[model samples]
Structure formats: structure tokens, C-alpha cells
Target chain A: MDKKIKMRAEGVNFFYGRTQALKNVDILIHANQVTALIGPSGCGKSTFIRLFNRMNELVPDTSLSGNIYLDDLEINSAQIDPVEIRKRVGMVFQKPNPFPKSIFDNISYGLRVNGVRDANSIEERVEASLKKAAIWDEVKNRLNDSALKLSGGQQQRLCIARCLAVDTEVILFDEPCASLDPISTAKIEELILELKKDYTIVIVTHNMQQAARVSDYTGFFLLGELIEFGKTQDIFTAPQDKRTEAYITGRFG
Target chain B: MFTTLFFLGLIIFFVGVRGAKVISWEFLTQIPRCSMTQGGVAPAIVGTLYITLGAILFSLPLGVACAVYLCEYSPKGFMVNIIRISINNLAGVPSVVFGLFGLAVFVKFFGFGVSILSGSLTLGILALPLIISSTQEALLAVPQSIREASLSLGATKWETIKRIVLPAALPGILTGVILSIGRVAGETAPILFTAAAFYMRGYPKSVFSEVMALPYHIYALMTEGVHPDRQMAIAYGCSFILLFLVLSISGIAIIIRQKQRIQHG
Candidate 1:
């Protein structure tokens, strides 16, 4: 089977005011695969992922020079609306930031924003998305309850359900499990693998084990640079770059 | 906090004890008679209500919109900082200065005249800085992560603010409004030149009619009336009524904020 590219970034460079955060880099995210980015703190992994959905533009005084494509469409072009780009490429943050609203509203929010106002269809999509995120069984009876009342792990899954409700082609997880306990982390890892069969995923994580366990392709980043990129198995067992090997072997972060 | 509460209680008590005798049902319902020494402060009460309501109606939407624009859409840098500083400075400007501005602009230039329309516009201007600053604070308090979540789901910036950010910041915004109501009701200087009549016979016929307000009425009763002792008592009653009106308005706002908090939680 030939793998197709879902997203591609070419010669991407990013700066926050005077400080360069991402050096010239190239990466490809394959369709229906989990691509994990592993790096230490401040390695620009999060920055790179944010660019996939144009999330980096939210920060003031930040600029990017790159060709970022969702399939064949250049997302950074002036003709493309970031709002439209974001609908196609959703994001789940490190922290489970649920709106201080009811569980139903939280999931339906994306659909409503995308101009889906039919009550019956919204209800159907909400339930389908919740089930897809594997949180429906836990929250089925309390859809009207405040999303904040859910546990941290449940909230993270609800966030994922929120992304899924939008029917995004690519979902970016920026350290989605960084704040979760081991059990919650395991649940999210499982969900990611399950989600990959339907949606292309890009996750940034500090846990090498997580990257190795879930991702088909893994990219290792270091100090604003792409240090290595290959198949997860090859990158872990036979890293081509010494920096990637040293970091993977726990020589130094 | 106790000290503040004690002073508030003492002031209310001091006025209530003296004013209780004058505050009959007739005092609230009847028009003033006997050269402002007899009858009720009905016109003053009605006038104060109109002006305050009008001020809120004028300022709330404009202030909240300004705050939203400044916080969400404006490019963050020198220009925004300057605008922020100017708003803060506007808040610090004396009420009398606003009265003069109202006298010159809304009264003279716009030809609204010295009536409820002029006074309300004056008080609205006086309240704008407070409302804008409070609203800005409220908007800023909403977590950026929530905004990111909304935007990531394809919500436009306006949609995010209107649906999410504004609702979340509502309690804080109401707090600002509550404070402004208190100030707008009690303020004598802003309404003195632009709105308040010395003594009106009946309820204002329209926004064009000059009306008597509680604060200015109280001031008039003490200084302008012939019967000093009787007028002094009436003034106390007016003060008490004014206090009650401000409290009730703010009470309603507080209740709204409470409901919002409960619903959001």
C-alpha cells in the first residue's frame, strides 16, 4: 500500500519577535498515521505543530516563513482563511481546556461555529464524536453537566471529542497527555492509535516511550531544528543522527 | 473590610434615622409642594431613575465594544498602550469636567439642551471610562487557552468573543456596571450643569424636559429653600431614597452575576 501525504512543511522558519524559534525545516505527515514529535523543553516541537493549524498566529509579534500545505493547499497563503484552515486541521492542547460550559455545548461548539445549526444533526454528531473519543460511556447520562466537572483525563477526552466533532482531516495534539496521570496517558495513547485509522495525527510529546509506542513515524527535534526523522522503529533502534541516538538513549536531553 | 462596612452602615443609619419621619408613602409618590419644603421627591426619584437608566443604556454597549476591540482585535503595542492610558486618565478626570464637556458638546453643539437627554449623555460619558476599564479587565481575565480552543475549532475571532469570551467575562463586566450605577446615581457634579432642574412640578414629559434628580434636589433643598430646618429633613430623605435606588440597581446586577457564575459552573 502506498502512503499518501496529508500535510507537508517545507523550509519552515519561525520567530517570536527577535528570537528564532524554529530553524529552516522540512517534514511530511502521512495520511492515516500517527506522527509523533519528541523533544526536550523549548525544542520548538509545539511551535511546529501549532503552524499546522495556524495556531501560532494567535501570539503577538510572531512570524513564520514557510510553505505549509494541507494536502495540496498552501495554508499560509493570504487567500486561505486561518479559520477555514483550523476547521480542517484541529488542535488539542497540552492542558485539557474545556469551555466553562455544559458537556453538550462544548462538543457542539465547533459545529455551531462551522454554521451547523440543525438540532437533530448536531445531536447526532455530538454523540458520534463522543463515542469516537471513547468518552461517551462515561458521560452519556450527563451531557448537560458542566464539562469542568469532569476529571482531568475525561476533560482531555472531551477536548478530543470536540476536535472530532469538527470532522477535521488532521488533528494536532500539542503534548495532550503531559498533564495526565499514567492511567489517563495510557487511555489517550490508546485513543490516538484508534483515531489514526480515520484521521492523520501529529502529537508532540516529551515521553520517548509514548512516541515509540504510538507513532508510525517519529521526528526528533533539538533547539529549533529537526535533528532526525524516520520510521519509529528505525529511529529508536537505529538512529542515523548521533544527537538522536544520544537523546533517545538518555545520554542527555 | 470591617472598617469599610462600619462606615457604610453608620452613614446609612445616620441618614435613615433622621430621614425616616419624612419618608412616607406620600413622600415617594407625591410631587413637591410649598416651595420645595413640603410633599414628596417623586420627580427627583423618577428623574434619577431615567438618567441612570439612560446612562447605562448609552455606555454599556459602547464600552463593552470598545473593550472587546482593544483586548481582542487591536494590535498589541504602543497604540493600544496609549489608548489604555488615555482611558485610565479619562476615569481620573473630575466629574465637573465631564459636566462642562456635556454643557459644551451635548447641550450646546448638539442642541440637546439642559434636559434628561443632555444629563444622560453627560453621565454616560462619565461612566464610559469606568465601564471600558472594567470590561477590559474582565476580557483579559478569560484564559487564552479557551480562546485557542475556540479558534482551533474554526470559530472566528468575533464568534469566540461573543459566544465564549463575553459570557465568561460577564460576571466581571457586571461588577463594573454595578459600580458605575452607584457612581452615576450619586454624582451631583456631572448632572448639575447639564441635566438637573432646581424644582420641577411633575414628571418629565419627555427626554427634552429638564428634571429634578435626588442628588441635585438634596443640594437645592439645603441651599435654596426658605425653610432651612424642614428642607434639611427632606434633603436627608432624598439622600436615603438615592441610596436605596443605587443599592437596588447594584443588587439586581449582583444577582445576575451570581446566576451567570452558577450557570457557567
Candidate 2:
């Protein structure tokens, strides 16, 4: 099988009502590599990541005038259902949002919604996904307990496990550890490194060190523009743009 | 002044303590007849049960659906604006006006004259706006992220609504249902206009059977009846029962809301 570019966003200009959030941004993401989007808050990195799966489409008064491609198919057209694209492209939010249900049910929710009704299959897949998320050991004994009873970090991992259970092809994580503690953040970074071996991962983070640690390629976003895009090492160590250089040096975010 | 305040407090406390202590298993399980002095509140109790049940069944689905549209699917425009205004007005409409409306519509047009159906429909309409507003509040309280998360999980908008949004809002929706039930139970104006018969000696035989609700009976007992002792007894008994039912339902709704708040917090 030939490997393909998993996602591509070209000349994507997005706006919230009259205010433009992204300005003619373009990028190509390949399969099985972690692409880290680093930018200051409100810099459109989150907006850019959301556009890949059309999750940005949900915001009221939000508009997009660009094309995003997934597996050679244009995702911006009516022929492509946003819901279907979202299935193939999963999203984990900044806040840990486990359903107010049991651990097993939280992980199995996506599968159940997709019409998987087999009890044994759902149970097996939930365990496997939780194991992959590295939360199986922590929550195995408490599968029947309410997911809300878990600690914050455990809840975030449960969210990751839930995404995996849906069998998503590409995972979009928008600041998955921003609300978590440093220990939880480190754990998620480690999981992202492990996750990239099997799934294509795109992440948005404000932390330069996180991008340096986990990403294969890093895209630096500044003032709604893609200022730099290259191998993570190059962007952090030998960036070719002054704006990118200035951003990485901590002078300005 | 201090003695007066203390004596007043003591009287109120005694009444509450006596009411609580006096309530036995029979208070719930027994069927009231002529009076406890003459009989208990059997007929009014039965009428309350049927009317409240009928109102809930009639209003819950319609109320929740309306709320879902207002909160989730509505475009911000003139029509939604009009609907919001009308619903608010309907909630504020005098219970007497609701009673007259019920008498004109359900009693006359539907031809279910002086019957349970008429009363239930009137109560349902009266309660609809409340449930719709409460449900809208509940739906609004659900984080938009949860809906987005579900939709992005390959679920269609309806699927997301049915699965995540509704489930998350279930306890909240039940809060609305409970509140509506509490309101309907205490409603006497609509019932009087639509279904209050002069005298009902037997249990209602069918949906169209004209029945005597507790409020109407209390009204009749107070206004015209010769048995002052028995009538006053009935009034105390019915008021105690009605007050208890209303408090319980409202308390349950508050608890459900509190639980949801705790989870979200």
C-alpha cells in the first residue's frame, strides 16, 4: 500500500463574523507523524486544526473560504459529510470531558453511537483502547464507577481512550493537557509519542518544549499566518523566518 | 414584642410538628370518603392523581421538543423572537384566562365537556410554557463542547443530540418535568373552569366523567356546605396533602438540578 498525505489545508482563510481568525494558511500533514501546531492564544492554530475535520463549522457566525483535503478527497464540499469526516478524524478537547457515565461506557460511547451493539466486542475494544491510552491499569478496577469520580488526568486519558475506541484514522488534539498538571502533561506527551506509531496525530500546544519533544514536524503560527513549517528540530534550532525565530526565543509569543 | 415573636414562632413550630407527627401510613394509603370528621379526601385525592398524570403525559414531549428547537436548532430571527415572546406571555397569562381558554377550546370544541380530558388539556397548556423554559435552561447549561465532541465523533447532529446532548440533559429535563408536575398539582383555576362539577358522589367512571378536585371541593365546602366541622376538617386534610405533594416534587427537581451542577462544577 502506498502512503498518502493524510490531510492538507490550502489557502484557508477563516473568520468569526467580521474578524478574520486565520489568514491564507496552508499546510500538508503526512501519515503516522505527529505534527505540532504552536502559536500564542488566539493566533488561529486551534482554528486551523479544527478546519481539517470541519469542527470549526459549528461555531455561530464562523465562515471558511478554503479547501481542506483528506486522503485526496476535498473535505470542504457538500459531497463530503462533515459528520463522516469527523469520524475518520477524531478530536480531543482541551478540557477533559468524560461522559457522566461509567469508565467502560465512556470509552464505548463512540463505538455504540456508530452502531456497534455487541457487548463482548464493545467491552474488548474499550479495554484495548484504554490500554493504548495507558489508563487501563489505573481504571481497570473501577470500570463500573462513574467516570466523573476519577482525577482530572485520568479523565483526560479516558477521553483519549474514548477517541481511540471510535477507530479514528486521524486524531486532532487541541491543547489536550493545557488544563492538566505537569505530571499529567508529561504523561500525555509520552502517550502522543507512542500514539504516532499507529495513528496520524495533529496537536496544538502553546508549549515550545512539548513541540520539540513530541513532534516530527512543527508549524509555527503567528498572527493568523503560518510563519514557519519544517522538521521540529529546524523550526526550534534553525528556523528560516525572523518571525518564527522571534517567537521561539521567548521575546514574543 | 419579644414575647409576641417567640409565641408566634412557637405556634408555627407546633403546627408543623403536629402536621408531621399526625401523618401516618393511612394518610397516603386510605381512600377518603364523606370526611374524616365526615370523611377524608378520597375524591379530591383521586382527581389530583388523574389530572396531574394526564397533564404530564400531555405536556412533556411537546414541551421538550419546543425547548430543543428554541435552544439548538432555531435561527436568531424574527420568528424565533416572536415564539419566545409568545411563550413568555403564555406563562404570564392569568390562570383564569387559561381556564376560560380551556373551557372554550377543550370543553367546547373538543366536546369533552366538564370532564377529566378538558381539565388535563387545560393544565397541560398552562404547564407547557414552564416546562419549555426550564428545559431550554437545562439544554443551554450543557457545554457546547460536548455537542461538538459528539458531532466530531462521526455522529450526525440528530445522533449527537439523541446520544450525548439528551443524555447529559436528561436529569435537567427531568427537573423541568418535576417542576411542571408541581405547578399542575397546585393549579385550581383551570380545573374549576373545565371540570369542576357541583357534586360528584362516586369515582369518575371514564375520561369524560365530571369529577370534583380538592380545590373545588374545598371551595364548595367553605362556601355553601352545612357541615362546617367536616368541611373545615376536609380543608385542613386536603391542604396538608396538596402542600406536601407540591413540596416533594419541587424538592426533587431542586435535587436533580443540584446534582447536575455538582457534576459540571
How well is each residue in A144-213 modelled by candidate 2, as lDDT tens digits? 9889899889999988998999879899999999999999999999999999988999999999999999
TM-score of chain A of each: 0.99, 0.97
| Leading candidate by DockQ | 1
CAPRI class assigned to model 1: medium
> Model 1, B187-214: lDDT tens per residue?
9998998999998878999998899999
- Model 1 residue A108 CA deviation (Å) reads 1.3
Window of ten residues with lowest summed lDDT in model 1 chain A: A57-66
Which residue pairs clash within candidate 2?
B32-B42, B34-B39, B35-B38, B35-B39, B35-B40, B36-B39, B36-B40
The TM-score leader among the candidates is 1
Off by over 4 Å in 2: A1-3, B1-37, B261-265
Candidate 1 lDDT score at position B203 = 93
lDDT of 1 by residue, A1-253 (tens): 8589999999999999999999998999999999999988999999999999999888889999979999999999999999999999999999999998899999999999999999999999999999999999999999999999999999999999999999799999999998999999999999999999999999999999999999999999999999999899999999999999999999987
